[model samples]
Target: MTCDEAQILLHALLDNELDAGHAREVEAHIASCPACAAELAAQREMKRVLADTKLSYSAPAGLRARIEASMPQARPQPSRRSVLRGFAMGSAVSALAASGVVAVVLRQDDQQRILSEVVSAHLRSLQAGHLIDVVSTDQHTVKPWFNGKLDVAPPVIDLTAQGFTLVGGRLDYVDARAIGAVVYKRRQHIINLFVSQTASTEHRPPKTQTMQGFNCRRWGERGLNFWAVSDIGGDELTEFVDKFEAAMKVNVEG
Candidate 1:
């Protein structure tokens, strides 16, 4: 893995959020790369200092009791019929929870968290030298750069003809694992197309979400999840994804 790839994962490694495979890879890279080794040491020192510091403010005594006193008095106990009704409602809720309704809710929350992380990754890529590990416009060169680095490399399409120029690719972490990011340029704007393997082989349609002033279009195809994030307008971003997807289909069928 390149330093650029290892740099982003250092934090995940520190937090023990990375899977075993990724943790070993980052650790191995840090061992041989002096620059990355120093970086890891500095991060560890910073974390240690922060942990020793007292940053949280302690609430004053009686705060909860005072707030409770200001509120209206509690209502009387429910009648026997009302108590039974509440019991029935609670049972129904438990049944729904067992039937995966709660899992659906949790999945939505996880999705939002991933989207936030994707935008953060995009912003981090905007920093100098943090963008691409392999700097090249050739789709053939960029695609193979991720061969053994990632479990599955992202599709590298030369979309220069479609207005989004293929620039390079890199390894980035999302959802606690290393994933592939294919970089593209839409004029001055940068697009980071992140790809990761998914357990399910379901093909999901693209959904556009705006976060932190950037537009993100995410979808799933052929058991892989993809997120394309950029500052470009929504319509143009959609056009980019559409064209990119079409090209991917052609490649698969051809």
Candidate 2:
């Protein structure tokens, strides 16, 4: 594969989406070309970093119910004849409806872009020399430290036995509200988990998402919304979430 072609397929190569033949060609090119090799190395490192960091966030409990209530009711399927007539007429109403949907979708995309940016900034901060504005392992100390800094108290759980120690936390402004950034450590890796009390709006469930070398998982429960981001491996990160959730469940029950 030429350098240009390899560059075009870089993301797909990282995602393991390329066909076997294409994958082989890209790999061969990467091995022979120093620049491509460096790029591949960087991508691999980003994946590792995302998998190694330990961050977690919880979505509010009411968010799901509210989302269900707010969802627009499905319109009755149009009759074949009605559909044909509308197509023939190039209906103004249909055009307007389509435009409105596009507008809403664009707006939502913009919001998501902003959220990603905020998350990226927070991630960069952790890598910098100063990670925490308030450093404490005690949940009591960490929770209350945000009393005046944020409007809501973020849950601070210590998972030292699970190989993730509570490093500390800081307050961040995101989605037009003050959110909490809880720091944790897994060996030398740092995980930054953001938490906030969302209103009655259900976001996408907690699933692993990768953005610019970071892995993020978002979920909601008990009126709390959680978003965990790290540069940790997918398997290990999922394991961390499983253990963290189990511990949180036990704590809640108690």
Candidate 3:
């Protein structure tokens, strides 16, 4: 395959989303083509860095309760009609109520979809044969790779001394913009740190939330918004964040 063709299919190839025939073709091309092989190697490294970074935070105790409370409640149906004519009308009303409930439920489900996607993407990255798209611990190398492909520069920080080693960074399309995902590793856990430059009004303080056993923490400061996710326990994740924040502060001050 041509270099351009290989480049176009590289992500899908790495994702193993291509059909057997296509996968074979791509593999053969990479075997003989130095350029394609280098591209594949870069993608593989990115996945490795992401897999090694272990970070996570716990959801506050009332998170689920709050979400449940905020959801709209279904109103009770009217009393059963005495006559056949009234009964038909009552049935229609009941149907409408049921539909309304379904709609509300779907809306709530949509609200949680983003969180689910974030976690699922991380998990998918960990699955066998899936990992980094570009692997490098150097911010200069990783950050430049995203130029022209994304609108903003994701701040890359190395936190190795603090126990969380910077594996690398990548550009991810999430919440409507190309955001930054800085990969880090803590022992056996892999942490994904997402960053974006949002408006001040859009900024939110660091808060932890959990979904499907994974932990997520988000906060905004100094013109950037950040989200960190992992399967690690709350205490350890929090400690990582504290250290990360301290590192950020030092960088900013310097």
Best by the lDDT measure:
1
Please list the Cα RMSD from the true structure of every candidate, rounded to 1 decimal place: 22.4, 22.4, 18.6
Across residues 152-225, which tens digit of lDDT does each residue of candidate 1 receive?
75788999999999999987756556678999999998999999888888889999987656789999999889
Q: For every model shown, what is its TM-score relative to the native structure?
A: 0.57, 0.53, 0.53
Worst 10 residues of 3 by lDDT: 74-83
lDDT of 3 by residue, 1-254 (tens): 89889987878988879999999998899899998899899998998888788756555524533443355522122222322333355664334333333333344464355554455455445553345556887767777775544445666777787788877765554543455678888998899887766667454557787754668787787677777888789888788788888777788798
Best by TM-score: 1
lDDT over C-alpha atoms for residue 56 of model 3: 60
What are the per-residue Cα lDDT tens digits for candidate 2 across 3-45?
Answer: 8888878779998899999898898898899998888889889
Report residue 38 deviation for candidate 2 (angstroms).
Answer: 85
Q: Give residue 169's error in model 3 in angstroms.
A: 2.0
Winner on lDDT (2 vs 3): 2
Which regions of candidate 1 are displaced past 4 Å? 1-108
- Evaluate model 1: give its TM-score: 0.57
Ordering by TM-score: 1, 2, 3
